[model samples]
Target: MRVAFALSLLAALLSGCASHSNPSPDGAWINQTAIDAAAEGGNLRQALLAHGPNLEWNIDTKGGKAIASNGFELSEGKIVSAADGKLRIDFYGNSFEDLTLKGDALVQTATDSGPEQRFKAPKEAAPAGAQPGTSFERGLYSAYLGGKWSIVQGEGQGGVVEFQPDGSVSGLPGNDRYALCLAGDCAAMSGEYDSMWLEKNEQGNPWIFVRSGNQLEIFQAVNNAKADEMPDLRPGASQWVLQKN
Candidate 1:
């Protein structure tokens, strides 16, 4: 009778262990809530609502690799454990935290004090012909526009200006007045300002032009935009050309 009781206790322990086993986080996850938050925050350059549902996080726990799209850029990083024992992905020197698995969802936080963002695995595969990083590729023009640029041509030929990722500019001529016109009618505004608009050049190169008052400044990439590298910019001699500094 005692031997039978011992055998039963062993079985109970084995069952409990099996029940508490950690779930695998080896798949794709989409975070619609985070995308909605970005849109609500007046991020005009963020992904459109229709495309937001396709942005995803593809994680490979065993391979210690991960790729994520932030509506504007695709970042690939390594899966690592945080100092506080949370799972995180280190992307281009930035740390994305709290990849904790809770039930059928994956929860994350952009920063230590940021709100929890939940992600779920999609029931069906992405629509046909959609690349894994398609959602992020749209923002490559904006991404390549970031950083300091020296005005090599046009009116502000010897001055320096900085273009932020969020579409804000500093160090331009005048009172440094400029508004972000990523979309909509930017040219009608009657102010001496640097307003940006997107278009394609005759050579089929992606061009981002800035309208500073009556003068229109054009910028083209010195090299192709790459997911892993930042590209430089050059403009025509007639307009303003900025070289990345």
Candidate 2:
């Protein structure tokens, strides 16, 4: 009886799947018109939407402005050009292509990020003026970086450490507690012990740098690690989270 019941359940599941297996039109495929727009009107968003996937663009029309949207994440973007019938867009740190619009359709081809995905560009509304990384933004970033901070999290056994704008440093990204004593108005780090956290990483070269005003590059970064160790310590990209010191 149990065997019979199992067979019946499998039959029912298969029947249901068969019912929903009908084919439908695939509008997501790229086309020629989208490519034409990228070549003419600089319609990147439209071209990608129409010719590419079902992704909406988070367009910006200002210098150093950031926009957010579902399906795709964008940062470090600026207005390349915008006018009566012209549109151009680009993103910093990431790759994108230049598109031109003409009438209802667009022509888009990959300008960056490899061989590129070329197809028909869709129609999208023009972006408004608002850029990222302004003077006010930089000030806010500096304020966020000011005062003491602890390495709340990172790879390895590296624990928490504090920062003083006085120039001294403590705690490694994933290692010992680095310290730079300060007297009066001066400070400097002595170095890390038993840890390659603070050093230039002569061996593996673990590195850290600011990608933008609000964006910080945090990665494992090992110049040389064994095949097994590599998967565990590769330089995967991640942004830094700000904590009130």
Candidate 3:
């Protein structure tokens, strides 16, 4: 009888361990810490500041699906459990990341030796129409319009232009203040300034435009160009590119 009791205790202990081994991470998680760190000039702060104030990861393990959004882009992925118990998310393309459940948070490392970042479940629901993956176009516009930019291929090649947060520009050729064409009727501006707009290329990447007085200057993000070559900046004969500084 004592032997049977000992065996039963061992089984119960093993069952408890198994139960705690794979906790279900089936919900939405946000990296609020990263948002706070961005305000303090932490790593990737530029992109973070350009995007909205938050980053989110949504996991649906039962459906083997996951979504990650950095306000600008929404990436959908497949979630799978690895042999070593790490949760791996394979994004649509070649990108992927692994996560592990800590106490109440999911931890992920940007690289093998990078610091582990924590994502916790939000305490409150996101505001209406303001959830992750919903502000891609607006975030993309903000990213291109904010901060310092360098003219890479336009008539102002090699010159630097600063787009201040107060809608003022320092080094643009013929315009002082600028307004983003977020919606209908960009030409109906009430102020003396240039108007900026964005359009997607064939590859779905964005290209920017600025109507400075009468001459329209087109721009592509320098980072998106091919190595040692410029993209075909069309709609006009001249090529224009902007590199974020």
Candidate 4:
């Protein structure tokens, strides 16, 4: 009897594995291609990453909205399930779509069974990183730092921070001014600041150390890239992800 039960469980697991041919949509998806015949020259030029249960839309990270009505808006979403190469998306106000995974592309079929839209994976998660200890040049980053940097982790994970050339940082409501200190590639905030520098992560992504008295807060830079694309600027939570404009 025990042997029979073990065989049943193994069969169930095998069946589940056989269901989906495409890789799971749990990581970043870049390189898009819209082969929809009815797509009147409407290009699907965006990518998405399913960070566990949360969906990270590229437009939101890049700071923009869809140009057309069919264009995907900058919003957050939850993954109902991803199985058999089919993914169901649910957003606020009952908005959703059923997508299929075909090879390295994500296909979204029209309601009328019209042409389908596809999002392809990029060659790499992000562009290659510069060697560690690369310094931040004030002249190159001055403009990018002047504005606001907000958190992109769905909700309540981060606040906007502004950088001034004089090595001062400010922007969360009611937060006092703080001094910005840089050594090599790492950055820190001290003097009336809520956190201080500790150390960077093993991946060597851009990050900041924040230790307020005894509490610690680490912010990692996401979408880190060279100045040509955009300044490596947005920092979110402990991962310390940053993408600058």
**Two-way lDDT contest, 3 vs 4, winner:** 3
Residue-wise C-alpha lDDT for candidate 4, range 1-245, written one tens digit per residue: 99999999999988877655546554444323221211121111111111111111222212222111122223445556556767666664456656677866666655553344555544334323521111111221242234555544323347665655434556433333332332212222221122222222212223344422222234654545665754344545564322332
Best by lDDT: 3
Instruction: Candidate 3: list runs displaced more than 4 Å.
Output: 1-23, 38-54, 82-85, 112-115, 127-245
lDDT of 2 by residue, 51-165 (tens): 4331223333444232322123323345466554334555563544443343333334454443333332223212234222121122212233334443434442224444432
**Number of the top candidate by TM-score?**
3
Which candidate model has the greater lDDT, 1 or 4? 1
Query: How does each model score on lDDT?
Result: 0.51, 0.34, 0.54, 0.38
Quote the lDDT for 212 in model 2. Answer: 30
Tens digit per residue, CA lDDT, model 1, 104-167: 6777755544556677665444545665543333232234444567887766788887754333
Query: How close is each model in CA RMSD to the real structure?
Result: 16.6, 20.1, 14.6, 18.9
Off by over 4 Å in 4: 1-20, 34-73, 112-115, 127-245
What's the number of clashes in each of the models? 0, 35, 0, 16
lDDT of 3 by residue, 1-245 (tens): 99999999999999988777666677777765644443332223343444333366777788998887754456788985643436898876677788888766777756653445677776554446564643332333234455667887666788887765444566655556554433223322211222353222211333345443223355542333356754323232335665666
- Model 1 Cα shift for residue 197 (angstroms): 15
In model 2, which runs have C-alpha deviations exceeding 4 angstroms? 1-54, 62-72, 93-96, 112-245
Global local distance difference test of model 3: 0.54
